[model samples]
Target: MLEKNHILTPEKWVKLHADYLYNYTISRINNHEISKDLVQETFFAALNAMKNFEGKASERTWLIAILKRKIIDYYRKINSIKGKAEVRMNFYDDGEHAGEWIEERVPSSWVSEVEKDIENRELGNALEKCISALPEKYEIVFRMKTIEELETEEICKELDISSSNLWVIIHRARLQLRKCMEDNWFKK
Candidate 1:
């Protein structure tokens, strides 16, 4: 347990990276078992690749960077199997799977009843409607940045807008969405 420049064993490494792998995979797949397996695979892959690791970043960060690519690869494999339709679940359909992934709901005895009541489809739907109703240009920018997970530079290029325009539209879109959520969704 005490040594200079101790090398981490595989078992020790797995213990360290398990939580991160699980979370990152779940963020992509929303399926726990699959995510767990992917994480296991990621650890082994990282272990094999450790020879090339120059410690440019900490070990945990390196594993996580690997895990992100593995998650992306998982999506690619799932897309190949299921086609693009399943990959692109319509925002209007049942969002139970969507609801399960975000960790917004957790087993808790401590939350107030009022707080519990505020989190539901009524809010999700209202937010969706508000997003749907925005001007097309603004909506495209907001959805690409927030939902589709595009980077700002990519979004600007795709929308043919300046960085400043992107910022303005995103800020306005968020404000409008927030107002809609407050007005139509919040159970006040």
Candidate 2:
């Protein structure tokens, strides 16, 4: 407690920042088990790489950066395994109209109403729920580029995806979120 320039101990980090990391991760991921695993992995990675930590950033920032990369990797791994299959089944069910929304499922325009509703707490909650309901890759890309306001190039680099792929994922995510909000929030 008295040391002027002392580095943070691992025990101190766990006691202090674990909950913060958990909350930060759960807000993005919406999965308790996976969030916990990522937080733990962040700690392990930070510990192993402590030698390279230059202290330019705060400890929390360093750990959170590692955790963010871990989350991206997790999304990539899951997407690689199940993304193509799910995309085929969900978005390409029609033989000749792959990736186009069906007439019945097309989202109604709510841009003007959305501006007003953005200030509403209930709308915020519904938005969170809708974003959480998106597929993992879409959710990750949507959050990174939209809510997190990361640059498109940064998101592409972090996710190891091309710019066009990022745009397509974001487009699909927005469509799904629009439909979800219509059904859950606007309809009611």
- Compared with the true structure, what per-residue lDDT tens digits does model 1 show for residues 31-117? 578878878888889878878776557777778778767755654454255322222212333555652423322322332454776
Clash counts for the predictions, in order: 0, 0
| Off by more than 4 A, model 2 | 1-8, 50-65, 83-101, 107-120
What TM-scores do the predictions have? Answer: 0.44, 0.69
Give lDDT for model 2.
0.80
Q: After superposition, how far is residue 51 of candidate 2 from its true place, in Å?
A: 5.1
- Most accurate candidate by TM-score: 2
> Candidate 1: which stretches are off by over 4 Å?
1-8, 82-188
* Candidate 2 Cα RMSD after full superposition onto the native fold (Å): 4.9
lDDT tens digits by residue: candidate 2, 88-188: 22355657998766667765665455566668998889898988787787887898788888899987877678999999888778877777888888865
